[model samples]
Target chain A: MSAPPLPRTSAEPLVPVLAIVGVGLIGGSFAAAVRQSGLVTRIVGAGRQGGTLARAQALGLIDEIVSLQQAAQTADLILIAAPVGATTEILATLQPSLRPETIVTDAGSTKADVVTAARQVLGDQVGQFIPGHPIAGAEATGPEAADAQLFQGRSVVLTPLAENSNASKALLTRLWEACGARVVCMEPDTHDTVLASVSHVPHLLSSIYMWQVATAQDSDLRMALAGTGFRDFTRISAGSAEVWRDIFLSNRPAVLAELQEVKAALARAEQALIDGDGAALEDFLERAALARRLWGSRSGLA
Target chain B: MSAPPLPRTSAEPLVPVLAIVGVGLIGGSFAAAVRQSGLVTRIVGAGRQGGTLARAQALGLIDEIVSLQQAAQTADLILIAAPVGATTEILATLQPSLRPETIVTDAGSTKADVVTAARQVLGDQVGQFIPGHPIAGAEATGPEAADAQLFQGRSVVLTPLAENSNASKALLTRLWEACGARVVCMEPDTHDTVLASVSHVPHLLSSIYMWQVATAQDSDLRMALAGTGFRDFTRISAGSAEVWRDIFLSNRPAVLAELQEVKAALARAEQALIDGDGAALEDFLERAALARRLWGSRSGLA
Candidate 1:
């Protein structure tokens, strides 16, 4: 529990034990990335569904599969990589077996609720819990869709709650770095707000937009004629429904505020069109285009 | 003028003269694409600004720069590729010199407006005017950005106003085909409505979304943290402001309708999130995701 002794030798010691719970796309990808790096001596995966755990091992994403208690007892690093809604129960189950020096982290999108759950379950042991989110995924779900390079060139934001220890935070940062992610530090609330604007709100907007198109009177014909523009605009709408549901629920206020802001902008555009104000429309489009170009250039995206 | 004699040869005869107006991206690209095919014996360009003609010829987008009257008098095929707002004025200038048998057409986004303009300016020669829109472009603009292959693998939608001559329609279709585009026919109103849904509305949404992000309190941080999701969502928002503004003005009604529908969907999502109705949120996301996947799968986008 005290400051951990430094490794005896200069050579980087292998990750003694890394446990990934709920080995789906994110978790499975995490295990795969770590295993491929050869930095971990052993990677163990635990999932409620036996099929998922079996599939993770079969895909060579993990060195072994174990129960929650077993993984907590053995792992120097415990990664709770499950759905946000499942985190509380998983934390409760693993708390009893967790050791004083064990470092725990999560890859959940919503952070405030998860941090609260960790504090409630582990109390003083919450110091070992470093909450993190890896902003990488695909339209596809399941362990079969996991890729070692999923996190490459992407960010993994860590929201270390007040109780989190510096040692635990540093170790978690190292793990994310080893997985080829750029680590960022942000408060949990800030993380939620930023994510609502960038990730969660975009997903919802895409879904809502697609729903509007799909429900059109001549949807079949429209879908038939839909090309690259429509395809890309609605691509994120195809993300996992359950995961998004939990995210929207957890981050409702921020999401709603963001949506209202977008709606106001849309209203202004609609009003300009109704008024036949070409100059106003032009100005709006020009401003928006300039902002988007600036964002794209800054983000290093085409 | 009554009935142009069909060429008596198996091979299609080269177009003796071609006139391209505007000399911007679309106009210049059309000239380049036509010249590259060697289907036209001579290509002439006309624009309000002399510099555009010089730039078009300098960039090899056309063989020669000519006066609007001269280009109109000499050309067998006259292609207008100016912004929708300029179509009316361009038609007025070219009408006095339009040869009786000239096959005239436009590459404007809005067909109904162009058709209206043709009816006013060309009168009896309205039959010679075909309204077309090429559904292909890059973010870049100007004559220098013109590409001969811009229309390759892209759809060129033609709206031949009621009572258009079959011969005129056939000639325009052939011209687009020669330029490497698949041509499709639709009513002017239908074309406008479909484009509003697939193109105009998406642009508005993307722009509005980007505007919202730009106005956020932590705009810089959010921009720095933005990933591919935000990039793709806002891709169209980064296009030419003037062009998009004209599109919004020209297709005002349809864009407004689509915006209203999207707003309703966003409102529903907002309500669901506010209520913390996880089931409703999941259902909305699931249906949207399913619809998108179905559309993507059918369109071969996946």
Candidate 2:
């Protein structure tokens, strides 16, 4: 545990012994990817679900399953790879046992809340926390869905604290790059705002749309007629409620702002339809279609 | 064309020659599938875009490209494959030259309005018009996107007129079956209502979400970080504006009803978030996840 923290590059053993606080898809995938890259010598997973922890170890996503206390005290690096809402409690539990040189980071969807939780729980040791959000996941969940290439070419955003040492930030960046991700730095507020607009709003809307279809009086008939369009549009509606509930509540303000924006835009289309304004509706649709196609082609998607 | 003139089922040349008015993805795919099945001797395409019509012929989706007038005058079956809003005008122009043995049908997304258009333009000839919705399409369009197997194993809902002779209905059913579709009969109004809840609403919501993202102040950054979730959620927003505008206008009342239903469902989630009710939000999310997962497996999509 030197002051400069080894070499902070690919030459260094970034995670010689790493500890992951949650053994779900995100945590397991992080463990799998870093281990595959030879950046981590061993990965210890700790979670409330002992069965899942054991399974993750069996699947080679982790080297061993340990208790939270043991994970907090021994690892060279700590990853709080749990839900955003769980940040506070986990940080509080680990507060008494944390070693200063052990770089602590997280893979939570919401950043501002995680920052607040770190400040409250870690006290003066908050500098150890460099909050991160990897914009990658599947509809599937758990350690069983973990993939070694999950982070390849994907974007991972890091919100660093002013108290965070330059060596620590650079080490985190190199570690993520070794895992095959493109790392970008941002303010926690900026991360939360952008994510709410692009990710959280779409997820909530998809769920709402699915609930509407499934609860309608003639729901069975309606679903029977649904096609590829409906399936793709509402695919995220199948994501885990346990994970999404925390994301929504933790990022409530930014999410609410984006939701309001969606409602206003939708109202314009609804108004155009009610008034039989074909021209207005067409213009609205044309603008959206053009934007989406431009982005789709730029992003190399069909 | 003629009052119960042609014999129904595959007993006769169900479609010795067929005319498709739009000749885009839907129309071209219909022609391609039927032609592959040997149910039609020749497929004639009519559209404002001569280039696309020519391309359809070159792709073998259509056997010939002709003027709307020529197609209306010569074909034994006139498939009004244009937009729903174009149905009335097309029928009005075709009414003067239709042969008595010709049986007319359409592939419009909305049934009730197409039935209205047929009634208004075809007069007593409306009995020959059977409205159909294929319930299959992709984000891509044009002749290049047309697939012969587009309708295979997919449901095709037919809303037949009271005036439809047993022969005409039987013939239409047999033709779709030939193209490998499972055809189900329904009332036009019922078809519209069911489609509104399952299909139309999802498309509109996706557009709204995309528009929301594209219009946000930091839209470029947000979209840059968008992952598979946003891509899947907004897939349908890339559909043709010109085509969707007509469907939205023609199916106004039903789409609006479903849109309202979505708003109500969304409001409940919004309330749960505002009240900081994790249990309520979790419950709301659980129902949608279960419903979507069930449907996904049933439909062979994950």
DockQ winner among the candidates? Answer: 2
Q: How would you class the docking of model 1? A: medium
C-alpha lDDT of candidate 1 relative to the true structure = 0.82
lDDT of 1 by residue, B8-78 (tens): 33255557788988888888888888777666778889887788779888887888888878978899988
TM-scores of the candidates in the order shown: 0.92, 0.95
User: What TM-score did chain B of candidate 2 earn?
Assistant: 0.94
C-alpha lDDT of residue B99 in model 1: 86
Which candidate number has the best lDDT? Answer: 2
Best by TM-score: 2
B-chain TM-scores per prediction: 0.90, 0.94
TM-score of chain A of each: 0.93, 0.95
Give a tens-digit lDDT track for model 2, residues B1-302.
Answer: 11244444444466889999888888988888888766688888887889999888888888788887888789988887777888888888888888777888888999988888789888888887788889889989898999888898889999888888788787788778778888988888999988888888888888877887888788889878988899999889999998889989888899998788888888999999999999999998999999999999998645
